[model samples]
Target: MELETIRETYQSGRVVLINKPLQWTSFDVVNKIRWHLTRALQIKKIKVGHAGTLDPLADGLLIVCIGRATKMIEAIQDAPKEYLAAIDLGATTPSYDLETEIEQEYPVEHITEDLVIETLKGFKGEQMQMPPAFSAKKVNGKPAYEYARKNIDVTLKSKKVFFHEIDLQYFEPKHLKVRINCSKGTYIRSFAHDLGQKLNSGAYLQGLTRTAIGQFTLKDAWTLDQYIDKINRLNKYKVGEL
Candidate 1:
């Protein structure tokens, strides 16, 4: 927990649980940590990476691996993930989220609480899912979003993904919220888009927060400020010593 201890162990490896802030990419969090740690530990460079990539529109629990711990990224990414997602019904977007403008709208008048609950149940278990075009999923050696940004039509392949659980937490006429527990590579954005189709309506992701990954929970993660302040304090103490 002390600065000296962290510096000594950093090369060996350290796993940091960060509560990633909204509008910040997972890589942003990694870069910030690496920058501070490099300066604090007086190291020339340090390896840092995140286990999974969270969208800029979403926030919460991001696992950052430092030094030797970077090797664990693959294993950590394979862990099951949990999310709290807010979905906007009766609307659809090209990105299946707020990143893109709504391109269509459908009727939510026929949708009811009972129907929503039943529809959510159908999503459980193994099913094929298509990742959103605005996602980091690679296509032809470039992120799918590259082509999507260029307005280039690109066919995407659907992959088998399993939904461990999908619980409707709240529902309204035009919006609903759910807590989802799913396997690796599951995209909540795509799930939102697909749910609308199944209900004979349209929907898009309004907001999202990753709550957990394997055993790591958002509750146990540190905010960027918290970690930065700690590092700064240690740096001040080191200066005092000198």
Candidate 2:
């Protein structure tokens, strides 16, 4: 793909797949790409938006819409998502993932392979799920995380979500790894919290990597560095040059 072609495509509107890095929020990826695109094309501003939000502790495919393609954001966000997650047994956290420190611990000695498999089966199909308190979901015009940061308690309602698949990839006495295929509003963090209660032991999301969004897979996505380097090369090219 040529530099000019990439710029022109984005100018006309295109969907870009980015493999988001850990510790960087979804907005971080959007801002980085938007900055590079404007510089490469010498545009003062260009509309850029992300289709879905991924937590800072999570890494994986993020669909970015450029120019007029931003209009598809709501539709794209409604698509199903796939994730590979690691859950650490015997402990729980306020935020449900590593984003928060462990607040409690429980015995995992009774957790076994059969028990884990059974639990996985239980989560399959449709159910009501509560979003994590530390989430982007809005609460009375303000984000839930904002209220949480102020130590204010807010009641978040449960939303209906479907888990099409839950494949167990690995299991141990203290940890379990699984690939989950679920609906749009599903929150793995809250799932982790619920899983602990089901097993009568505590659990928290130890790791997570989003592998797919609708038909877009992480394998077909570009890393942030890759996008940046390509943009740099494009910026070096002069007018009328390839």
For model 2, residues 1-242, the per-residue Cα lDDT tens digits are 55556667667777888999999999999999889878887778989999989999999999999888999999998989999999999998888988778888899999999998998899999989998888888999999999887889999999999999999899899989989999998999888889888999999999999999898899999999987786677756654442
In order of listing, the candidates' clash counts read 0, 0
Pairing residues by index, what is the TM-score of model 1? Answer: 0.94
> Distance (Å) between predicted and true CA of 8, model 2?
3.8
Model 2: how large is the Cα RMSD against the reference?
A: 2.8
Give the residue spans of candidate 1 off by over 4 A. Answer: 1-6, 235-242
CA-lDDT, candidates in order: 0.91, 0.89
| Tens-digit per-residue lDDT, 136-236, candidate 1 | 88889999999999999888999999999999999998999999999999999999999999999999999999999999899999899998776666645
Off by over 4 Å in 2: 1-7, 235-242
